[model samples]
Target: MPWEAWPEGGFPRFSEGEREARREKLAALMAENRVDRLVVYGTWGSGDAVHWLSGWPVSREAAAVWAPGEAAKLFVQYRNHVPTARRAVAPEVEVAWGGPWTAEAVGGELLRRGGSGQRVGVVGPLPAPAWNHLAAEVREVVDLTAGYTRLRLVKSPEEVAWLRKGAALTDRAVRGLEANLRPGVSEFELVDAIERAYVPYGGMTHIHYLSVTSPSAPDRCVPSQFPSPRRVRPGDVVTCELSAAYWGYPGQVLRTFVVGTELPTEVRELHRVVEDAFHAAIRALRPGLRAEELGHALEVVRRSGFALCDDLVHGFGGGYLPPVLGAEGFWTLAHASLELQPGMALVVQPNVVTPDERFGVQTGELVVLDHGGPEFVHRYPRGLRLVG
Candidate 1:
């Protein structure tokens, strides 16, 4: 199924087999690099690798120490969090408290496991003190952030299932916003509407950005990173970028809405060009397609004499992977040589705007690449919406 609501008991979790597979992959990478030990760190607001390896969403701080053929030792900070970490981590992992300092705890364990002089592979943003501690114990400390990122590029079946659920919740949130949209509604209230739609089902908010401006005298060309107290007016245009998460996975969708029945001529033209660009990029998406080739799809926007204020496309799910491309003439393309592969998730957002950056419209959603083509993750109704 393309869309799935939260399950009866709670959200589904990755199986033990899945966790082992990820560890095996990481171990293989470590072997290739001749590393003796691997340390995966996780702190509040930044713990993708730790969660992937140990299955414990980081609370304050956490670290997992592993060696070939040995069970991972997970160290969590704040003495009180140990109980939850023990419950959440995989059955094979050994959970412990990091004492007063997590880095020293992990470094002490590394020293005990192999003494000094072993090469260690580090993942995530391990703080400087932790890095120095590890360095003092190991012959060399290698940064394996890129290697970890590469491992996350392709999703397993279980990960894809989680992403599908996230997409459904995200769609529901957008519909919630649309239902409550009307003149005099404050931007903060719009956020409340969105949260109300998915929070009941255990969904968490990843992002809910809003941009409310008068269409006739538009001042904003892109969604604000944070919502404002500005109220929706009769002829106001609202552009939004929302991502509702299921677990750590999230599906992103961008859209524009008008508070009145009629769209301003400039807004209509801009949306038409954006829709064209969205479709063009979707049609060009396929397995084995070079990342730079996808940038060509946005030529229609340039031809229509409209510019873009946001990225035209980017890799999503598991830390914004790669191949972040912008409209041809507007921004530079990164990871241009990358290729789209099956099971990779991407967000194709075409935030079309005028040259003067006065008017704009956002349209797009997350999609997963397949053997044949891209599959839309969201079922939200497409095109510009008219509200009130």
Candidate 2:
């Protein structure tokens, strides 16, 4: 069944209180930066960061700046000025519509807007020209990535509630595929099952990423479907990796399945070793543990004898997945020795290879940290499950 077939309330929206809390946090962030004002840019969901900060998402190539003294303002380009300004912001935030700017025009406006000599901060995946133009002014033009991200890492009560609803709906989608997936099913068909099951509750068009693999073609399966006619076989190792967005927030998940009745001894052992390593990483997860130290804990598994596929564990929330968003390569992880704090959420995946098997297993659980160690947000079987 298509996701549109599901009930309307399957994924719930954040309440009004949630929006207010976000604004309060921004007020605090501006105070902490000690800047007279902060500027943000981008559109669509890429603009979501600023949208998140100011309670407005931009529709045009515009800028939203928050001055510590008065209410925030959103300035837009021509054509989209009214609708973008009117539609993009929270009721509490104010919007300003401005026309297109040439390089000369932008500099003049910044100077006129009390931007000169101010130690302003800018955030987002902005064009170099736009960023440089802003940086060109001021005694200091700081990148508020860390300051903003730190504020973001901890979810508010409302965010937790919104994400939990998304996870539960995703879990239901996985369950649908679990029951119907089999040897003759094409990878594309499986992909369809996942998407069909995800919508109707505000899953929207921010597509999910899917990958499937088999032990034989360890290098070539399920990264995504290509309308393949290839049939699942007895020895195939099935897997899929995904992240789906609800509203503007993202929830990531991974699942593994094996074909046939039994596993080869080598595959079985590799699974067990990686599973143990995953548990070790979980045990080490808690508030006050260093991100690198938590990353280094994966080393214990390597020492204990699981060959790591990669050195990666991460901070995940509010974005789509190509792995690690907001940086180069397929993904990026934190380098600081900072302690993991409460309100932080993470996905702990420790999968690696054994001497004989060319492909190993990757299993994961989305976790939310609390006074307890780490609570699994989306639970699937920890050990491998064989699918016919």
Candidate 3:
């Protein structure tokens, strides 16, 4: 197969088990919600619903509808609007290339094929303009809220294996980049070091979020730059929030490194406390755990001493993440009593940041929940590094 050829091994080249898993989950939701037919719709960044049904990933916009007794139909956005939609969607999509349509029309097009008023379930964020369109057409829409989300919470064994590759790459990115970092390097230089180390290892830009911090201010990871402008001095720290990807699957890792020389006394203590909290969170993972139970584990860090800016951990994959993690629409069961199950991918980095105080403290790793406990995707490092 070429670099872009797909459907190899009976699964989409980018996602193994994603299509069948999504279909089964959506069908189950339709049955549970009494939806005779469901319009699992989306556009651009809202591709979650579409990806949740078909193996196709919509870069710009796309839609899919599933009927109880029929195959799902997919629709890609028009050419003038999104070129990538055409490339990303499978060529055999049941429905594609509509002349023009609102978000609701995207749904309506699929509904038309499936039959209207069929007790439809909607799975996308509908804009006001499109809401009117869907409202006038499909009167009944069960939110399908937890129905689909809960289904996505747990990963399959295959997803875990793929995520592990990403995690390994992220670990390499962190370790390799730090070895190249130095006192005179700018943020951009450091970013270059990270990605130069990272890109060859794994990915497309999907999970490339990273941050750099100085040891004097150890808590956070900021975006990268060219020249990085701000030079690292002796005793400075570089904190990284880097993730690697095998296709679009992500494995997040956060690690701190010292530049020039040794870390300060307070920074070392802060790192220790944060690492303690992080491992404690890992220990707390299991099939019957609550999402918010991590807050308690974070407190263990807070007590050991450090002010955490908030949020201990979050869900991962396909834009599904906590609001604290820069996600626009993830249903952060982060604070709820939601049960943690095996096979879920998680990025837990309990960072302690001070809005007014100097120097932050944190470290984190991606882990897959296993039957016995959480299995780390990213290799755990024993200590921070001192580059040059």
Q: What TM-score against the true fold does each predicted structure earn?
A: 0.93, 0.78, 0.82
Candidate 3, residue 331: Cα displacement in angstroms equals 9.2
Candidate 3 global CA lDDT score:
0.62
In terms of lDDT, model 2 sits at 0.60
Clashes of 3: 15
Candidate 1 lDDT, 119-167, residue by residue in tens: 9999998999889988987799999988888888888889988899889
Top TM-score hit? 1
| Regions of candidate 3 where Cα sits further than 4 Å from its true position | 1-18, 42-47, 78-92, 98-104, 114-116, 200-202, 207-228, 321-335, 355-357, 380-382
By summed lDDT, the worst window of 10 consecutive residues in model 2 runs over: 320-329
Which candidate gets the maximum lDDT versus the true structure? 1
Clashes of 2: 4
Where model 2 places Cα greater than 4 Å from the true spot, the runs are 1-21, 42-48, 55-62, 75-88, 94-112, 115-117, 136-140, 205-207, 220-231, 304-306, 310-312, 319-336, 354-358
Model 1 regions more than 4 Å off: 1-11, 327-334
Ranking the candidates on lDDT from highest down gives 1, 3, 2
Query: Roughly what TM-score does model 2 have, to 2 decimal places?
Result: 0.78
Cα distance off (Å), candidate 2, residue 52: 1.8
